[model samples]
Target: MTISPDVAAVSTSRSQRARHYVMTRPTFFTVAYAINPWMDTTTPVDVERAVAQWETLRATYSTLGHTVDLVDPVPGLPDMVYAANAGLIINGTAIVARFKHAERDGESVAYATWMDRRGHAPVSTFHVNEGQGDLLVVGSMILAGTGFRTDPRAHAEVAALTGMPVISLELVDPRFYHLDTALAVLDDTTIAYYPPAFTDRARAQLQQLFPDAIEVSSTDAYVLGLNAVSDGKHVVHPAQATGFAEQLYHAGFHPIGVDLSELLKGGGSVKCCTLEVFS
Candidate 1:
């Protein structure tokens, strides 16, 4: 595949931009119920370790010259720690998530309250949408995932709200329920993804859109390595995803590994716990 000049420039220069992020402390993190394949209710959780790991992720963001904001954790909402599902904040508008499952439905209100208090114009949608979990911003387009968590109808809502062209991608694997789980946006033009997780049409779309994108191995994809947060230059991903880390380095981007294994039991990692707030 011929790499575009813009993508080549991004690889060569490795330019970075400061980001504003919202993170929730894993104060109530645990696997009490099974919502995804990574969650096993029978497996015991280490709450203390989860909190420590979350703190480290937060500190890492601060160390990277990015601003970090915190939202108070709700007691019964264990999955609230995955703050990225709360809402999609972009272009000065916050489209709060309406979760598909009842288990996480309450999170929408909590996140909306936080966004409202912070002066972000919070908009509510009747359709089911898991915020950044299913919607990822890539340059001027929004890549939306469906067939698992978020509803296809929400794709139109996102386009209407943000005024950005949305490309709908169908997720076939149960494990990679969210778009973030199977794909990571490395920068405005670059992406890293696992092809098997998507439908044939979605895979074709990705290949057409990002010809120079990195195709990660299943080994790294299972570890939620594609659930990474990138700041144009630096990619923050799971420590267990060693192969993905090496790929990022070879692609001319710096990859920082962070251990969020404790939270991984709940089926989330770096990007899952972190939500980028575009003001």
Candidate 2:
């Protein structure tokens, strides 16, 4: 069939738009339940509010033109809501975590099952690792956390699994148990972090690696500001992190804050609830 010049131009325009949409869309994983801290069982959780906040986060991602996926939340396992702790995804392969604490050990199997069902080859880890909670992908390198929830030996396991270079950064403070609690990757070369969370050596490594990283304030870090997610453009952070949001805006990023205070009682906020699904 011979098409007219105008018709061909319109067809080309549609094809270009289709490609743009496919290229820009991002995929993420989430869970329905709120992960309450085992140490603080008495801490009250408004299940209704937590669910509403999670739904809002999902809606926000959907509105921003992204794919949001889910994993079933087990009744007894409260920490399952922090889906990022389940596994690390690289090149669409899942390296499922082996939890150090028995309380969250069952989560590994649940996430592994989901990964298998989702068409990703799920590989179980022999060493203790808390998935993305302790692993942050920056550029071509993986910044892994140690001296806290995740074990140092897991770095080698991750490197072996993904065939990517892993840099082990030790965490010192108990408050920032996971790497996600104190750091966020804004882009390939840039990151936002709270210095106090890392040990002296880890802080130096971060400075050397990311010279232009934004240093978040203690006040903001206390509210889990660094536990934010960015699409190399817009950043989703805690609503009360206004100062950090301004800094993000100055750094050529659009910051969107969604309140997750109810979930904070469980020692998590935004990033913990969202897991990146590698394509």
Candidate 3:
């Protein structure tokens, strides 16, 4: 029995796509050069120092032999969430997000420009919803956090855009600003998150998705800088969370913690410094 040419080609394409794990890594990270986000601390001096960390982080990734792309900025808006805002690498194209926050409204220009200049074609743009803040791209499904930076309508839009079901996680607490802040997908069957941080239902949903989630303490969460890396498996949190560090070790990730007192003062953790561009 001979398979059709289209069937063989499609089978190989599916295999190749599955092997490509979509994760964002920052090469260019700036700490709001246009704003005083340091919160009166002299540690970083200015946003330049924070951006310097990106340079260092890139060098580290280079050692690991992972080729990363650092995206340029959209002019005017200072606190544009490069990691949290726009451009999700779902299937093969970058689906630009419609951010919920007005301050970050114009943030897409820079992303669009980068995609254009680099020949990174975006599949499409959404005028209906917000950006990556609402998304949590796991093994297969896309989990979306509603009532925060992402909208309910946007959730439906992402589902149609990515051709993957977008699961909704309501933002019960404003403090856990993004979906990632409260939870993370460590692997297809494992997770790393604090219990109290997630709602009863959200926690239940996480448990359903990843049953072997490594529960983290509130204190551990703060110290580990759990809010940074988009991919939980490849995390770079603060070194302070000893317990979480051990948990990460068992999970098979080499943790890189930084002196984040300066970065934390402005309410950003490890994930903020890195904005991932998926190919």
Candidate 4:
């Protein structure tokens, strides 16, 4: 059937207005001075460096117009990133996550409280899986990675919990650990990833998801914190992401690099240390 002029224009506008909604942890929201794994057991210079890094990241994000909400770091949980993992923002409300590590199990309560105070509540929760960090949101499907931090059960758990299809891949390197660690969905049309992080099948699926994804290298990927919030054409990589910075610049992303020297000692990089909630 042919459409009227007004109806056609309205339909096109609605289609173009569609945008991806993401939940990111404001780097400043957490008690990183006491919780970042980089401190290990804690030291003089370590604490000082962590504080500076956190402050700078907080200011950077604030300047970008994102609202930052500070949350009390779950005492004794070193993986505060897990707290951000607790809620998966979909539609609008937060979807609480079932963290694999016991160290972060308490976030369910902490985040639930945070959401409650903000006049939001979690609609559902996973007893066996984490957030979309391991689960990449490409189009309508969720590509989740299994092994290492993410258990095999996490795959079925997340898929069943969220009512979304899950494609799971084995971890290529224990070091890279999380899916976001070695890969990033730069845009619906592009993904920034390194080969070492993907399997043959995973790579193929990624290609199918976004054919225009520009391939980056592990060297730069590691430094840039590949998973540190891609897309939006604005990348917040670590100061060390030299090669990736150039790539981001070429791709039209304003790459803002923050110092992360202390984080390296904890076996985590920029992405691991911080949670980014979208505005």
Candidate 5:
């Protein structure tokens, strides 16, 4: 029996794509403006602290031996510090985002320009989507978040572009606006999630898909424990999520903690700042 050329091509591409993460330096990072429920105009952000935290995360990825690519941060776009919202990239194809809010809409152009220069096929989105901040890839499936930052229409667009099935999950908690904040894809078969962040139906869907997933506690969730980044081995997460870190250790995973208190003011942490750029 022989496989068709199209089938063989897809198999080869999926097998060969290199794994990498994209980051934008928090050069002018701040929460001076409010867009989401997380940001408050009265709340002050420590720019120096945010940059240091971001640098640590970048170095953590470098120390883990994953390629850390940098995208130029545009002035006046303070939220660009959260690079994961830029777009979703898989097999060198980028599905550029169309932000639900005007505040972040300009980000799509910047990310598209970067993708073009990097030689990736850039596909612009029509419906509102906040990029990987609401889209997570696990093994061969995509877990997409909606009911807040991303629109359901964008999920279909993503599936069409990547040629993979997308499981749409509705977010219920405003604080965990993006799926990346409410859930973390630890490995091909494991995930860490906060139950309260998702609606009942969406929570059930996750339970069906990842029955043995690590259920994060409310305390951990408060500190953004679910917003973690893992390379199938080492997990980088917020230091404040102490209990979750211990849980990761007992579960046979190495968890490294970093303080991102400053950025937390803007409702983002480790995963928010890191975007996986699938080769």
Candidate 6:
């Protein structure tokens, strides 16, 4: 797909970085309960298809020169496969999630145990937080989300733990419950987002922070197009988000698409299934 002239003009070369990521195989992935809008208890999940798609995503990261670590899936915790929600790992320190919903509460401990085994200092939080789901690292700061899963009070806690400035962005739409679901960090200072997902104040903050950020179409946003992982250059995202992929390509990014349709039934995609381990 070709991009508009204005978009092409803004295209510039970006540096690529090799990253480390943690993932969990969908050994017990199923939608037996509904927490997010995309999830429905009545929906039948194809476990085999979900596993295959997750495998493809893992393989894609390996091909892109990134390291992949595995956290063993816990039985009966189906949503454990969405590893990003487990915790936010920054420079070898883990701030484990305090899940808001009881159904996913067990996943936090499972991930914390894995982090501890890996020599990461896992620290617990007092306020409710959903790890990378509500927290995104942008340049030298963290963009934190609230109004859905994470509590607003958790923002200051993350700032104190990481010693990084935290910018709280409130999510307004149920469909875009997490900051990662609505915004994809394209590079250290660049981002692509669905503006309507955030409140007016949050949108204003984003505009001031990233004036040239890509505004995604509503059609692509509904497909969770912004829920992507990027190592500065290559952006791994849902295969169905063709339009967003094109935008990434024109913006001088290598967009790699993978089919995670089965996992999407559980309200997660590429970024949700993968957690970046910064060191």
**RMSD for each model, in Å, please?**
3.4, 9.1, 9.2, 8.0, 8.3, 1.8
Give a tens-digit lDDT track for model 5, residues 1-279. 355576455334322223598999988787777777778888877798888988898888888788988999998888888889988989767888888878776778888898899887688878888888999999999999998889899889899888999999999888888999889988888899999899999999999999999999999998888889888767899999999997776565678998988998888999999889875
TM-score to native of every candidate shown? 0.96, 0.86, 0.75, 0.75, 0.92, 0.96
For candidate 6, list the clashing residue pairs, or say none: none
Which tens-of-lDDT digit does each residue in 1-279 have in candidate 3?
A: 354576445334321111222223332233443222233334343455555554555555455455556555544554542445565765566777566555556666666666567665655545445455557666778878765566677777778877888888776655666666666555444557776665788778877877777788877765534564524335556656667766665555545655544445545555554445543
lDDT tens digits, residue span 56-98, model 4: 7666666666555666765555445333355565445456666
Clashes of 6: 0
Q: Per-residue lDDT for 61-131 in model 1, tens only?
A: 99999999999999999999999999899998799999988999889889999999999979977789999
Q: In angstroms, how far off is 125's CA in candidate 2?
A: 1.8
List candidate 6 stretches off by more than 4 Å.
1-12
lDDT of 2 by residue, 148-210 (tens): 788898899899889899999998877888999999988777899999888899999999998
> Which runs in model 3 stand beyond 4 Å of their true positions?
1-45, 123-130, 230-234, 277-279
lDDT of 3: 0.56
Which candidate number maximizes lDDT? 1
37, model 3: CA deviation in Å?
A: 12
Pick the winner on TM-score between candidates 4 and 6.
Answer: 6
- Residue lDDT tens for model 6, 173-241: 999999899999989999999999999999999999999999999988999989999999899998899
Q: In model 5, where is the ten-residue run with the lowest total lDDT?
A: 10-19
